[model samples]
Target: MTEPTDKVDEQPLDEYLKGGSSVSRQYRQLPGADVPPSLDRLVLRQAEEAVKRPSRPAWMRWTAPLAVAASAVLVVSIVLETGLRDETTVSAMQEKREAAEAPIETRMIEEPASEPSANAPAADSAAAELVMPVPPPPKIEVPPPASASEMPMTAVQRRAPPPPVAAPAPAPLEEQVAKAEERDNAAFVADVARQKSALEAAARERELSASQRAMRGEQAGVAGPRDTVETPEPKAVLSYSRPISASAVVTSADSMAKLEKTYTDPEAWLKDIRQLRKDNKPEEADRQWKLFVAAFPNYEVAENDTAREANK
Candidate 1:
């Protein structure tokens, strides 16, 4: 009831807005200018405009897209590389597995067993490339079948027959006897001939030496009687005991006749004389030729002086 008589009641905020307080009235009386509805909103809008200014950098906007693209490229590269490696590994593994499961066979090669030739090269490259060959078993030899007599001997063999002791062989009786006789006769004849020839040569040399001495004395005017001249003794001559008898018969009985007969053919004697000349036995050839001429004066071509000169 007291409030109704007073004329004014307690005011609410909306009523206070219609009638201003001291502070609000002062603000209202300042000027009739338009005020913003929200000061905070206006400040926010100014800050957004400052951020969009021309002088500000735009790098932040492009950074996110660049990073995303780089990440995507890196992921794609890693995936492709992984796929290739997996495919290669799978192919290699499959090939190895197939080879391991396959069957295997072994084969042998044969080669001749012989000594290498010395003329071949010291280092043979072909031999190095060759595979080693397996060695064959040793060969076994079978003995031949024994005869009936040899079978009994083989059964009776004790300690292998003492390895068959060999005996010295005897020389032939007839050949030995003939060789002994020939050697004895040859030695005897050679001794006799050598002695006779030595004696004859010594006598001839002495005689010639005495003659030369006498000639030297005579040249010096010293004279000597013929009976006082010194002479060498006559030498004994060697002759065969008996002539070899021939199957052909002749009328002449003396040794000279046999000599004439032997010299008549003249081929052997001529050949012997020629051989003596070839052997440089001129003294023996002279003696033999004189005898031949004396015995075979009627021989063919032997009587010719030209043939005799050629022989000399």
Candidate 2:
């Protein structure tokens, strides 16, 4: 059996070499001098056929895999680099945001007042750099914003004081009435005084005339002058007596008593004789003179004896 099996295998090999087998065992083997020309020719034909046909190039065979590997490495490197950069960026942004939200410290500044020069400019940048930092606009006490209802009303201020109010003028009619009243009062007082003086003068004139007429009549009876030849003396008229009513006159009790004591009717007649003599009216003064003659008869006797001698 072993010998038959070996012989069977050798038969297959022989058939493969003869190209008469249904199956063949193909393998690369070294070329030999004993190799058939037909087989060599077949092998050469196969090699020529393979050479004539197109093939995948060496660079093409691995290009897809190498491209995939390179893309993965780039993705991983970019992810790592992005992760590293994000930490610092996020930290810087956060610090900037905090700083922006922080409140600023308040400060106050006062600018000095100065006399402006005509030639100097109002503001200078060089001067501003040298100037102490203006801390801030004087931190105006910024009171919290007021509600609409609490807003203060603004009133316009007057540049000058309001004009003075004028006093009211007097009415024309009232002014005229005051002036007229002043004039009327003065005229009334003057008229009163003039009337008093005139009345006093008339009383004195009447008293003198009455004494002269009385003396003239007595002298005319003694001389027997013709009435037509001699001018007649004017008659006298006595004026007012003392007022009877107390209401009509102002008088003192002493003055009233003195008036009553001073003159009886006969004494008044003697006063008339002396008053007539003082008036230089001897002719019509006899009636007043007769009272003195009756009072002193011896003086009348001397007067009659002198008259008798004159008649003789």
| Residue-level error in angstroms, candidate 1, position 270 | 87
Tally clashing residue pairs in candidate 2: 6
Task: In angstroms, give how far residue 55 of model 1 lies from its true place.
Answer: 6.9
Error of 2 at 207 (Å): 99
Clashing pairs in 2: 214-284, 215-283, 215-284, 215-285, 216-283, 216-284
Candidate 2, overall lDDT?
0.34
List model 1 lDDT by residue over 245-277, tens digit each: 110111123422333233322433554565576
Give per-residue CA lDDT, model 2, range 256-291, as digits (tens).
Answer: 233222221222333444455546666546654554
Error of 2 at 311 (Å): 99
TM-scores of the candidates in the order shown: 0.18, 0.17
Q: Pick the candidate with the highest lDDT.
A: 1
Quote the lDDT for 125 in model 1. 26
